[model samples]
Structure formats: C-alpha cells, structure tokens
Target: MIPPEVPLDDEELVTRAQAGDLEAYELLVARHTASAYRTAILLGAGADAEDMVQEAFVKGYRKLSRYRGDASFRSWLLAIVANETRNLHRSRDRRTGLVLRAARAAPYSEAAEDGAVDAALAGERRATLVQALRSLPERDREVIVCRYFLDLSEDETVAMLGWARGTVKSRTSRALVKLRGLLDVEELSRG
Candidate 1:
C-alpha cells in the first residue's frame, strides 16, 4: 500500500516492486506516469519520446534490486528517466533531436514569477522558454530539469547528480542565470 505521509515513499511498495511484484510496480507507474511522460515530452516528441519513457521504466524495474534507499525511490526513478531520455537524445540512430528540444510545460508560476503576466501569451511564451532551455549545456539542463521539472529540492538534485551541496547550488544558480538571459533574449526578439 502507498504511505499516508508521502505517496511515493512507500517502503513496502518499493520492496515489493523490487521483489518482482507487478502490482506494486503498477502502483508506482500510476503514481509517477504523468511526470515521466511530461519529462519525456519535454525531452522529445512523437514515438521516440514514448519509447524513451518505456525504456526508463523497464531499466528501472530491472535494476530495482540495486536500490540502496539512500535516496527516495522517486528520486532514483527520476534520475533513471532523465539519464535514459538524455541517452536517447544522444543516440544517433534515434535521430530524435531531443538534445535541442525544450520542456513541454512551464514551471508553476507563483508570486515569484511576476514577469510572466501574459495569460493570452502563455502557450507561446512557454514554448519559447522551453526552446531556450534546450540550448543550454547538458549539465545546466539536467540541473534545471531535476530541480524545477521534477520538483526536487537542491539536496535531492545533489543526490541524483552525485555532487556536493555547494556544487549543486552553484551550478543550479549559474544555470538559472543563463536560462534567464536566454529568456531575455527571446523576449526581446519577440518584441
């Protein structure tokens, strides 16, 4: 069964999944499929995107026994999906051009996003924003995806990336600054 405090932090579910419990694995899929699909779509489009996500889940299932519980299962799965999607983008035969693709949705806008006030222009702005994200360096893009798209905190990002806290902080900050500059340029060109 899933936990009360944390939906995705069910140790029993994870153990069962690791032990080849198909039901438990299905529960995990039900819980995280939206995010996985969104991440895949952000990384690519069409059939290759779907294939990349399917491959990630398959890969995760195969390696479930190796899970050490050092990080949350969701974190581990996100890392796997991210890696698989990135690898899929890199494979020449796939020719998905995902490496130059952008996210499918914008980060949730709160009071902090006062600059993005154009509701009628949301979709186009978001597409433009996603395109800019695709142009960033791999490390920058990964940090952004992990931190924003996956809604993982800095510590979780560090765990996923195998980097120190300071390094994650520095890299994420630098990446956001670069992304902001890209957005500014995009905004200007649109004007």
Candidate 2:
C-alpha cells in the first residue's frame, strides 16, 4: 500500500515559494491564514482584519526573497501581518475606531426592542475596550493580545513573541495594569 503524502514544513514551503513556486506560496498562505487573520484582528485591524490579512499575505509572497529565516516562518509572517495592520491604521489617519465586526452585526431584533439596546451597549463596551487596548504601547498590546485576547498560554506566548518566560510574565502584568488605567480613565471622562 502507498503511504499518504506528508505535508511540508513552512521552511521548505517558503524556500519553494522564494523560488517562484505559486503552489508553495499558496500552501504557506493556507497554513497560516488563521494565525494571520487573528493577528490582524488583535492588532487593531478589527473589521478590516480579513482585508489586512490578504494584503499581508500578498506582500509576504512578493517579499519572500528578503526573508532571512532568522525567525520561524510563522513569526516572520506574523511580523508582516503586524506591519500590514499598522499600515491600515495609518491609511485611515488613525481617526476611526475599530469595530469588532461580530458585535456590530449581532443585533437581530427590531430597533425598539431591548435586544437593540443591549447590542448597542455591548458594541460600545467592545469599542471602548479596543480603543483602550490600542492606546497601549506596542509591546504591551502585543503581550496583552497574546495572553488575554488570543488566550495563548505562557509557553506559547513566549514562543510566539520570542520573549523569555520571565519577560512574558512581567510584561503581561505591567500591560494589564496599564490597560486597566486606560479603561478607568475612559469611564471617568465619559461621565
């Protein structure tokens, strides 16, 4: 009996992609799209996460020759995703707030119903939280996303962020405090 074909590692796929193999590049995209999309959303792309991820993958493909492989391909791709998200924010002149798309679309009842009010309040809360999260320094935001938003364990967070375990611990602690302060300030100012 014939054995099933094994999937190639990202390194091999990337190497093949860099050599102009479109299929290999597609494989890479298929493998990492979820991670890319999540990174885009957590990094403030929000409702535009899908678009940002698509753009990031295209850019990653075009720039594959420049990838040095110093980091794992996933890490490298995530950095591209992050840059794409930042570019999206800049392109919007940073004036618009991110809408968590699901929250905005979840209200189903008539406008006069209690469901509408609940949905509106939920959306406002999510937007305020996202804004507070966006106010954090980049490192803090990344740590928070990896830990709380993405719910990655400490070990996974350490691997994903390329930080030491102790660094992850301290940063997560510090970032949470800052986020709380920002949310508190937002609440106080709104009154």
Candidate 3:
C-alpha cells in the first residue's frame, strides 16, 4: 500500500502552481490568507482589507512566473498585499495618499490585556501608540509595523518592503526613536 501523502512546503507548492497547478495555488492561498489579511489591515487597507487580500492573491497567481523565490512565500505574498493596499489608498485621494494606520486592535498585544482599570489604562496607551504610528512618515510607519507589530524579521521585512536590508535597519532605528519621542510626549501630556 502507498504511504499517506505528505503535505508540500511553499516552494514545492509554488513550483507546482507556477506549472499550472491550480490546486497547489489554492493551498498556498489557504495557508497564507490570515497573514495576508493581517498585513492588509496593519498597512491601512482598513475596511477594504479582505478585498485587498483577494486582489493580492489574484495578482500573486498571475505574477507567479516573476516570483524568483528570493524571499519566503509569505513575505513575497505580503509584498503584494502591501502594494495592493497602497494602491487602494492611492486610488482614493492623492492628497491624503499612503496613510499608514497601525492596526488599532493590536498595541504590542497583551494584545492589550488587563483588569478593569488596567484594561482601561492599556486601551488608552494603545490608542496613544496607534495615533503616534499614524502620524509617522509613511516609510517610518511601514518598517515599525513590519518589524514589531507584524513580528516579521529583518530579512523578511527587507523582502516585503523591497528594500535593502540596511535600509530596513536604519529605518527601524529611526522609527523607533521617533515612536519613543511621541510616546514620551503623550506621557508628559497625561501627567
């Protein structure tokens, strides 16, 4: 009797999908849908996040031939998600373009846990941070969200943002500094 079939990893799935295997591509979509959705929401697709994920997946499938496997499939797909989300924003008002809103639901996630008073305080803190993130320059917000909020690695962020690794490093450092300054000001105002 044949042994049960083992599940294929992303590379194998990608190879099959690139060769015209729809099932393999569907599996890839199933595996990454949540991540893609999260990336969309974090990157400010807002209420349109789901639709953006669908578009990203479709775009990813069409561009399969162009995917060079230089990055993990997740990061590669997220780059698509990011680009699609940005496009969504751009299609709206050019004057208010690329407004990177950090996901309000996440705030260094306890995901924002605590008792009644503690929870209230946590929520306020989270709101402050989210507001601060929203105020950051677009690129500054992107690196902070990718590296910290989304828990992506330095290299993964590089791939997702299509930046050199050093760019990610420097942007992250500067973003963190700016974020801290904002938080400090918020705290001072609260006191």
Instruction: Give lDDT per model, in order.
Output: 0.72, 0.78, 0.86
Highest-scoring model, lDDT: 3
Report the C-alpha lDDT of model 3 over 1-191, residue by residue, as the tens digit. 99999999999999999999999999999999988988888888877889999999999999999998889999999999999988887897552212234344444346335567777777777678778887788899889889986899998999999999989999999999998999999899989
Off by over 4 Å in 1: 1-9, 93-120, 188-191
- lDDT by residue (1-191, candidate 2, tens digit) is 99999999988999899988999999999999988887777666877889988998988888899988866788778777877877887898854333244334334334435676776776677778877876777888788877776666787677667789899999999999998999999999999
> Model 3 off-target regions past 4 Å?
1-5, 94-113
Over 42-85, each residue of candidate 1 has an lDDT whose tens digit, in order, gives 55643566677788888888898998888877767767777777
Q: Which ten residues in a row have the lowest lDDT in candidate 2?
A: 96-105
lDDT of 2: 0.78
TM, every model: 0.75, 0.67, 0.90
In candidate 2, clashing pairs total 0
Q: Order candidates by lDDT, high to low.
A: 3, 2, 1
Q: What number of clashing residue pairs does each candidate have, in the order they appear?
A: 0, 0, 0
Best by TM-score: 3
